[model samples]
Target: MHERMIIAGFGGQGVIMAGKLLCIAAMNENKYVSHIPSYGAEMRGGTANCSVVISDKEIGSPTVPKPTIAVVMNTPSLTKFEPMVKPGGLLIYNSSLIDQKPKRTDITVVDVKANDISEAEGSTRAANMAAIGKVLALKPEIASLESVIKALDVAISARNRKHNDINIKVLKAAFAQK
Candidate 1:
């Protein structure tokens, strides 16, 4: 059950952190996983993305040239990674931020209003968790909700641990919404 995923968004949206959470969850579930992060020069508004590979067997490489799933949180990311999704793959975009829909018909496309939902929850940053939740819901075999919670504990730092509840709330909300 190999799954290659690309999580992308502006630098401040926690794209890399989301990939790290996925990798941590996969590892906790005893699955082989890899995470590779790439970001532009500027920190806040620059492009940020990560390639994650999860599988039952050993992974050969971390690079994901064509991902099986693409989660884009911004319009630029949607424009950039939409074509990178492999044929028959899945594309999940934050509809609140990306105005344009995916043009591809071969692959499955899901519009997740992550930003709006997160904002409604009082934490706009939780949109990343919402997007991750959407992915886990669509592919239950990838990781369990318990694993995700545990990963959140490990991924977040001591200073930022206070927001864990909000993050979990947003995750469950997104999962339940679909």
Candidate 2:
């Protein structure tokens, strides 16, 4: 299966980290994957996004002009990426930060309370993991939850590894939402 995903949000939201974790998980499952990250001028509060492609076959390009799944963590990202999802695609939005609802009728939309879920789990920084968990729950073909859990060992730096437990908790919490 081929899955083109876009994870977008403001800086410090772990948009790129989420994409990286997904790639690592797909790689652990022996799937072909590509990750491309983009950042706005400002580091902390500016726009940040990444495109990830996971497939059973080779990927020709990393750019995702039309994504099959779009995970938007903020309203600005929702406005920018909502129209870019392919018809019949999946759109996961962060309900806690985004007050606006998606207007697309052709694609399936899921509102994930990423911030709230992560906060409940202990850290609001792990909202990205929560969002990724929701994505995997909806589309298990993209990557298994076990593989993603294992990926934390590789995705998170050694110094910050102590937070892995909280991240895992956030992931499981979001996954159970399905």
Candidate 1 Cα outliers beyond 4 Å, as residue runs = 39-46
80-127, model 1: which lDDT tens digit per residue?
A: 888889999999999989898899998999999999889888896899
Question: What lDDT score goes with residue 74 in model 2?
Answer: 96
Model 1 RMSD vs true structure: 1.9
- The deviation in Å at residue 23 for candidate 1 is 0.8
lDDT of 2 by residue, 79-174 (tens): 889999999999999999999999999999999999999999989699999999999899999899999999999999999899999999999999
Model 1 alpha-carbon miss at residue 69, Å: 0.4
Cα lDDT listed for each candidate: 0.89, 0.93
lDDT top scorer: 2
lDDT of 1 at 139: 92
